[model samples]
Target: MASFHFELVSPEKMLFSGDVESVVVPGADGDFQVFAGHAPVMSTLHVGVLKIAGNTNAPQRVFVRGGFADVNDSGLTILAEQAVDLAEVKSDQLMQDIRDLEEDVADAKTDAERARAQAKLEGLKALQLAVAH
Candidate 1:
């Protein structure tokens, strides 16, 4: 299979930089795959797991909160708002965060706040499901 350079970076640091066979991104509109010679495009990513293939070891799954994916002549570059490798994630902590978010949603004073909290809670739940499998 053909490979292409891929980079995943966050505000804190660079998460990944290497060649990959494919990458499944969590685009705001929907999920999309990038290959070695994919068409040039830019997309806003939502909260979801990024599936990466063609690495040295097993396929990787990384949780990304939000970001932008830019695909050009060089390769694919993702500037994530936040990202964490699933392998390094602590289930206990994730559960705690979900619990806290639930409370925030219930205690929200405004509709906008409630909606934001609810959306985040849903995103965390989705991440939890992905981590379980």
Candidate 2:
């Protein structure tokens, strides 16, 4: 089977770097899949689960808040604002975080503030779902 190099990186450090048969990303428009020799493209990513397949050791699942994906003949690179592996995620803590963000959203007085809070809430929701799956 064909495989491609995949790298997930955040400002802090590189999260995952390995070979995978395929990967599905939560693009801004919708979900999209990448495979070996996929056409070169770039996209803005959304907050959701990044599913990677064909790792003999284990399947990889990652939660990303938002990012940009750069794909080419060689591989795929993700530059994310925040990213976390499923195994390291804490569901209960994420729930608490969501609750806190909800409170902030409720208290937001300005439209801009509310929109910011709403975006955070959505990201938290995505994280919860990612962890669950």
The most accurate candidate by lDDT is 1
Could you estimate the TM-score for every candidate? 0.78, 0.79
Worst 10 residues of 2 by lDDT: 56-65
Predicted candidate 2 versus true structure: per-residue lDDT over 89-130, tens digit per residue:
777888899999999999999999999999889878878877
Supply the TM-score for candidate 2: 0.79
lDDT per residue as tens, model 1, 40-129: 999999888899999975339998888899999999999998787899879999999999999999999999999999998987887788
lDDT for residue 105 in candidate 1, whole number 0-100: 99
How much does each candidate deviate from the true structure in C-alpha RMSD? 2.7, 2.6
> Considering every candidate listed, which one attains the maximal TM-score?
2
Clashing pairs in 1: none
Model 2's C-alpha root-mean-square deviation from the true structure amounts to 2.6
